[model samples]
Target: MLTLHPNSNQDVVDQSLPVNFQDFIKSEFHDMKQDLTSISKDITSLRQELQDIRIAMGFINDEHNKINEKIAKMESKFKAFDALVTTVEHLRTVNEKLEADCNAKDQWARRSNIEICGIPEKKGENLLRITEEIAKKAGFDLKMTEIDFVTRVSSTNKVNKPKPIVVRLQSRYRKDDFLACLRKLKVICQDLGFAKNESRIYFNDHLTKFNKMLLQRAKVLAKERTYKYVWVRNCTIMVRQNDTSPVIHIANVDDLKKIK
Candidate 1:
């Protein structure tokens, strides 16, 4: 119902609506599409992170299982080691006990005072018996006696008492026979520190040296008035290896004997 000019009517119509409405709608759509795309990307990232977390968890679980298995094995090995240690301790204790028992037995044997022969008759009978036993063990038998005499002085201070005769047994038999006896006696006497040169005296030269040394010591010891000089004589002779031989005096104490 309105009459208007054509240009003014167009201008009025344009002014009635918003400007660039289609472009605004297109821009809004573009922004919304971009937002949706970003959201999708975020969701994909979140999913990948979750997957990584799950994989990591699986790996951690596998590692934990392996660790547990290793711990179990270690515990088993420790127990085995402990058992082995216990066994070794037990063995050591047993060995120590056995050794102690053996030592006790050996000590008892060494300390036992069991006599090998009958009671002795003379003052030096025990010494003779001991010597005899030692000799027998070493495959020899010889008589041993003390030499020299003791002379007591009289109360008057004028004359000394007559010294009693003292005799010492010298090996009267052949050097081989006496040498064997001497060697055996030396071995038995070695432990007691009675003499040191017994083992080294083998030949005639060694025996002569040993005898000279012995005589020197003996002379020094005979300074007592009661004892002047030691007289040694070989009393009896019997083959040690053959017990069936008759016992006889082979020589005197000073190696002077008839080898009949």
Candidate 2:
């Protein structure tokens, strides 16, 4: 039988091989277990971050939608306001056009002569004083006929009558003051009971309908708007002309004072 030769090199190799093999298996398995645990933790953290990102994105989207709705509502309101502004501007233009047209057509009427009597105020006790002065200067009589006039007693103008007059009185004067003036005129007529006719007093709220001259005079006298005035008809002169003394002219409050 042939015997195998055992050298020193073979003996050392045999002893080291078993120990190195055991150490390699133990180290590899421990490293593999630690790597798996680290990978699991990383995956869990990534999932949590993804959930947080989705929640933040949803909030951002909701805010964007709310902002958009508010912008739309504001746009609608602005459109309505713009339409209203356009209508008002159109109406203003129309009003201005109409006023211009009226002014063009009524030029003569606007510039007509307006004579305000009882103006250029001369201070006096009553209307008779002014009428007498004007009559003396104008070469006319301050006398009135004892007959009824064509116009009513409350007629604002005695324009055609001789020495026509306008009167004004303080608005604060007592009701009794007006009554007293009328009573005085009536009493005068009673004294002249032999006369054919007498004077009459009339009252009306507005006098503009009967006479433009009277209205203008009233406006002139009402410089500070503190007084009121009116008109009256009367008989101041009793002259015989035709069969039963033709009526020459009518009288005013101022002229009637001298009737008796």
Candidate 3:
């Protein structure tokens, strides 16, 4: 037999090794199995992320289209509402002016009127005579003709508390005299045989219906603001927080806001 001579080269040494290609392939199979498992997991995660992105992108596109459509619809309304808003604003302004003018007329009508409280109501009392008597007691001369109207405030039902009397005199001078004489309310109550508790009477200028409501609300606000007293003078409601505090005249609802 002829012996093969080995070439002294790197390739020759590699081929002369005891490890064969089949052994190498078998050793790599276990390592390749682990690598394939990791690769498969990576591919599954990538697919899932891609699917999530596709769904999110579709939702975002749909919402964006919806918003664009809504904006287009509202854009049309902007122009259409301009004229309507102007008309409404004009009507609101006119209404305020008319209301103010009407209130002025109402206040003027009540210029010579006076409101009296704590006057006990009698079943068949002569209200006119009682008013004249009250005027006389106040150190004033009042005739039956000088009085324009006299009546007690009406109520739906009879109440334990008497309804106040509203007396309308013919002249503003007579009304002033009536009010001035009311300052000596104590002496009048004593002469009239009224009890001490019943002596706490109130006399004030008759207020218009609107101002009456304003005064009621202002009184409540005054109490909340720690005012010592709320009283009316010359038909205007005034509030004092304490004895030394400056008087605050509440002419309307707007005046109440300054209290806070």
Largest lDDT belongs to which candidate? Answer: 3
Give residue 36's error in model 2 in angstroms. 3.2
Clashes of each: 10, 1, 0
Which portions of model 2 miss their true places by more than 4 Å? Answer: 1-29, 102-108, 113-260
Write down the RMSD of all candidates, one decimal each. 25.0, 21.1, 8.1
Q: Residue-wise lDDT of candidate 3 within 1-260, one digit each (tens)? A: 11224763212123444567645654666578779888999999999999999999999999999999999989888867997899999999899778868987888788898888777777888888777777777767778898899999863336776788889888898787878787666643445555564355678888877788888888788788777888877777888888998888886667888676
In order, the Cα lDDT scores of the candidates are 0.42, 0.40, 0.77
Q: Which has the higher TM-score value, candidate number 1 or candidate number 2?
A: 1
Q: Residue 179: error of model 2 in Å?
A: 44
Expressed as tens digits, the lDDT of each residue in 1-260 for candidate 1 is 12235766221222334567645655666798789899999999999999999999999999999999999999999999999999999999898778657644543332211111111123323344444455455565444442111111122112332211111234323323644454443332344233452322111212122233444444344443223334222212222112453333222123312112
lDDT head-to-head 1 vs 2, winner: 1
lDDT of 2 by residue, 81-109 (tens): 89989999998889767754654344223
Give candidate 1 regions above 4 Å deviation. Answer: 1-17, 20-25, 112-260
Instruction: Indicate the TM-score of model 2.
Output: 0.35
So what's the TM-score on candidate 1? 0.38
TM-scores for all candidates?
0.38, 0.35, 0.62
